[model samples]
Target chain A: MSDKKISTAVIKRLPRYYRYLGELLENDIVRISSNELSQRMGVTASQIRQDLNNFGGFGQQGYGYNVNHLYKEIAKILGLENHYSVIIIGSGNLGQALANYTDFEKRGFVVKGLFDVNPRLVGISVRGMDVQDMDQLKDFVVENNIDIAILTVPKTKAPAIANDLCEWGIRGIWNFAPVDLQISNFDVVVENVHLSESLMTLSYRIKDSY
Target chain B: MSDKKISTAVIKRLPRYYRYLGELLENDIVRISSNELSQRMGVTASQIRQDLNNFGGFGQQGYGYNVNHLYKEIAKILGLENHYSVIIIGSGNLGQALANYTDFEKRGFVVKGLFDVNPRLVGISVRGMDVQDMDQLKDFVVENNIDIAILTVPKTKAPAIANDLCEWGIRGIWNFAPVDLQISNFDVVVENVHLSESLMTLSYRIKDSY
Candidate 1:
């Protein structure tokens, strides 16, 4: 593998490629060319090569790439080997739902805590975890060493909550709220996940397909 | 405005651009150049111009673009003019949270129905709407003319649910499950919103930022 780092965009697509490759591997796929992978990903073959080249050369000229090795390499680059301790802010429906979601554990993310501003929700158990008071966030984060914060709070409170999350030493944030947040001088990586934006994109796709 | 349609990628980014423009409009930004928009969007200036140009010439050579009009035009093209009926499959924590998510109403999508296979949850009212049995999906879709289906079911059940949704004539699906689904000829748009993928991306970003 090359010493040069790959872009975040390329890294983001690695999970998708990895998932596809997992399926292919399960189906006994030993080798695959860039062209075939590109077709499956709905991207150009050259683009696939370029993305892979950023991490290092993958396939040879004639033999294509080894499926298992490619999967492992991608998994390593994505930091999927370690269990990520996560906390959900807002303890609302979204937070509680995510806390209960079984799929995260399979993907190397563990929900360690759920925090909320509402006193009524505090001490309530969702899935197996109790809803902790938002005031205890710093203590919980420091105690558990939480690195990921899932921002499922309302739009009005998202920014302030995000700031708190960063201050509490959360390294990454998966923002479900629609608001944009700004944080400085911290290693916090914020990824905004907008439901409306995804739905709107789907609507446009539906209209276009017709 | 030119008659040529924009690429799907550009179309998806239009809403993001519109959101930024909305902020600009609130601050009384009357005109914006492509360079400024590109900086805000994290894309190339020429790409911004190309995306805007394909829909129609919104940018002037030296004068830039009118923020208010551009925002409205993009909104209209994305069909945000009217509210769309939506059905959420699997009335678990995630589905209930999405049902209670107020942002959907703000973005012209209404969660009218919540469906589940569990008998206990079937008659329960969440955020003022009754959770219907999965058996009623076909009728509910036909009567309400559901344009969107939010699939929050388990991965194994996603494809079966998708099949039922397509048979009921639904077009767009916001898939929360981590499975790839294939739907036939009915303009099915599945937007895979995998939490694991998002988390892994966040992990990569955190590693890179340091």
Candidate 2:
């Protein structure tokens, strides 16, 4: 279990399990069988067991998983116990929305800076942080030790900014732009959040049923 | 191929393929083999064939698939030819961000209405539409015929909102709130966009390699 890294699909389900577990914990529930968790989460019990088994055997065969111990294990695997220094790479609506997000800090991610190409927005304050020019990104990343970047730029400008962000030693990018990036020989990881694509999926599903 | 219903996994991947096809079409790529498409998409060649075959046999044995024809077929299957009316619940930061998003229109989905519980925001204008009170949700859904509901409420309130939206006859929900819904006895589908989980995965990947 120590050497077996979790799959991407299982890793994405951790927050969901954590949220449900938080409710159970608040209600003073001490333990939960895999079946109960699966029923509540609308997932198969076997699937839940398989996902949990990726890290280690947390749940007892007959009893269940200890609530607190499982929570700590998930937190450690998700890197939630370690604080992440983040910077937003655009000052548009999406970036501003992210800057105003109160949930990130609580989830162990702190926005240290904001960057924009526009000169007017560069000097303005958004959610208590001054928006800096794109020219300052390299120095800011190096000096501030920024580990995570949120890309909210338009489609055309995303890849260039991504390349520059990688060059500045940024390792992770949460990209909101609807663009597929092409980069090489960098430690950077990009997660594309295409809003249109998600909506399109909804339209597809609804259309099929209706 | 015609008898079997397309899997949800295959349906989800259609948008990804559509995007890639769009790029290929732009570059004047008239035909593409399943192997080529799979390699470009980071999926197995056999998987590409299986997904396509589930919809219809659009590919030739040696000549491969006609890119334009395949794109059209996939688009038709995904209901992209028709426009979808979308309504947003919870006119908070995330909702505001989604309302201002113009990308959906490009992909045949229109943001027709915005709803909120806050009295202050109810009458406010956003993206050419006035934010309506939650009391008007039923009428709006019936009159405008909202095909999808975008849930941007906090985690604690997500389930209730989902239930309300479901009862209102929404066939699809794009849930931004970090919770798995317990929707019952409906054709409604929920896709959870857990922001923290995505970041956590990125962090874990970076940590694993570093």
Pairs that clash in candidate 1: B1-B56, B2-B56
lDDT of 1 by residue, A1-210 (tens): 767767767876887887888778888998899999887778899988887776566788998878888887888888877788998887877788888767677768898888888999999998788999988888999889998888878777888878877887888989988766777736789988877777777766766777
Instruction: Flag regions of model 1 displaced more than 4 Å.
Output: A1-4, A7-9, A21-69, B23-67
Note the residue pairs that clash in candidate 2. none
lDDT of 1 at A117: 88
lDDT of each: 0.82, 0.82
Clashes of each: 2, 0
- Model 2 misses residue B33 by how many Å? 5.0
| Count of clashing pairs, candidate 2 | 0
DockQ of 1: 0.65
Candidate 2 residue lDDT tens string, B125-190: 988889999889999998877878888888888888788778877778899887777788369877
Assess candidate 1 and give its lDDT: 0.82
> Least lDDT summed over 10 consecutive residues: which range in candidate 2 chain B?
B200-209
